[model samples]
Target: MGVLSAEGVLLRRSATDKDDALVQCAEALVALGAVGDDYLTAMRERESQISTFLGEGVAIPHGTHAALGGIRRAAIAFLQFPEGVDWDGQDVRVCIPIASRTDEHVDILSALATTLSDPAAAAALREAEDVDAVLALMAP
Candidate 1:
């Protein structure tokens, strides 16, 4: 599968808290066969060290260098929490979980950053109704 696919785009999700949201993101990545089960722990550790909240109701959750060995392939899972989740004080509606080896994540991050830099694009992603809409908005 590609970095972002229709299967990776999930809408109308809900999380009770930040950790819950992270867990859901990690689980989605695991389900996609992008990362191993231990990836969840790595994601939590990364979050504890620093906040992933990128503003505009979005958060990017990814594993750390230590978790690189568990990655099966590079992929991204997009989860939209319609009710929103509290991410360190900021309310986040989107949680994008990324799994990559070496420096591959940098390129993925750059592309996503560019897409999210536009207010309209970010808003569209947050409120996207289906996977196709999300794919279009996130298209590089």
Candidate 2:
């Protein structure tokens, strides 16, 4: 369970809505073998239950409470939609999809919140040209 790297970061993505963004992010996690196919369904279900949009043009999506069993590893998939997407009532420009087998989800969300809350860091992430830039913003 290492920190998310370039493999989990997607930049300049095109997504129409929250569903599209969620699917794209979840697919990235699946490709990384961080979670099973069931994770996608669980993520959608979780979204339907409550919007993960955390304001600040960001959204943190994760599987349902009961879908923890499908998590094989702790990882995050970040999708940066330059065009933005309609996340419930909020406009989300960044999507962070998380998959974890333990309580690490809380810590990750806390860290992400701290980073995203900073105008400079949030802007850096949205305007980053490469994965390295994005990674640096996340951990800086």
Candidate 3:
């Protein structure tokens, strides 16, 4: 299996706040066996230092370099919130939680950034209804 699998993609989800979304992201990463339990704190610390909210209703939440030791493997989780979560001041429709070894983190972010830079692609991801549709959109 690759970094992203059908099991990692969740659709039609909702969050009351940004922290709620982040908690779910951490849980998903844990459930996927990608990161240690403490990764949630790292995620929160990352968010505190810098907002993860990318443009076009998408947010990529991940741990900071210090937490890289907690990652068991490279993996990504997709959570869709149709109603949108307020991330600081930005409205986020999708939360993409990433777990990666230290060396692979930049590369994964680069590829995902390339794919999401496209307006249509980002929009498609936010509105994707099925697992296959999301998997296809997120393919690197």
Candidate 4:
């Protein structure tokens, strides 16, 4: 299965802070049976250790090495906050939460980095009218 899915996409979500964004995306993965409830905590811990902000209003949040037990599979959850989130010092509008168990993390991160590196793609994501548009951006 692919890392992204309809159930994992969120558009114009309202998150007060980083923890809120983490919870929203983690819950999406949990709903898809990709991760356990502890995934949220693990994601938060990872964020605390290192900033996930990738610039261009995007942040890819994932669990720490110790939190691997919480991941049931390799999956990704997308969250869009039109209002933007204060990710450390960067204003992040797109949040891609990842739950991975294999070496796929590198591949996924690389792909995401490539996509987010494009100014048009990043802008399209921020202005996306629906989930399908976001999915198109994530499509390989």
lDDT string for model 1 (40-124, tens) is 9999999988988888899999988899888999888899998999898898999989898866667657767887888888888
By summed lDDT, the worst window of 10 consecutive residues in model 1 runs over: 102-111
**In lDDT terms, which candidate is top?**
3
Estimate candidate 4's alpha-carbon lDDT, on a 0 to 1 scale: 0.84
Please list the residue runs of candidate 3 whose C-alpha ends up more than 4 Å from where it truly belongs after superposition.
103-108
lDDT of 3 by residue, 1-140 (tens): 67888899999998999999999999999999999899999999999999988888989999999998889998889999999999998999999899987555465566668768898888888899899988777766
Model 2, residue 30: distance off in Å is 0.1
lDDT of 3 at 94: 93
lDDT of 2 by residue, 64-133 (tens): 9798888888888788998889887788888889888776667657777787889887777777789887
In order, the Cα lDDT scores of the candidates are 0.87, 0.83, 0.88, 0.84
Better of 2 and 3 by TM-score: 3
Name the regions of candidate 1 deviating beyond 4 angstroms: 105-107
Predict model 3's lDDT versus the native. 0.88
List runs of model 4 lying over 4 Å from the truth: 105-108
* Model 2 spans > 4 angstroms off: 105-107
**Candidate 4 residue lDDT tens string, 6-123:** 7788898989987888888888889889998888888888888999888889888888999887678888888899999888878989988888888765765676677778898779
Give the C-alpha miss distance for residue 27 in model 4, angstroms.
Answer: 1.1
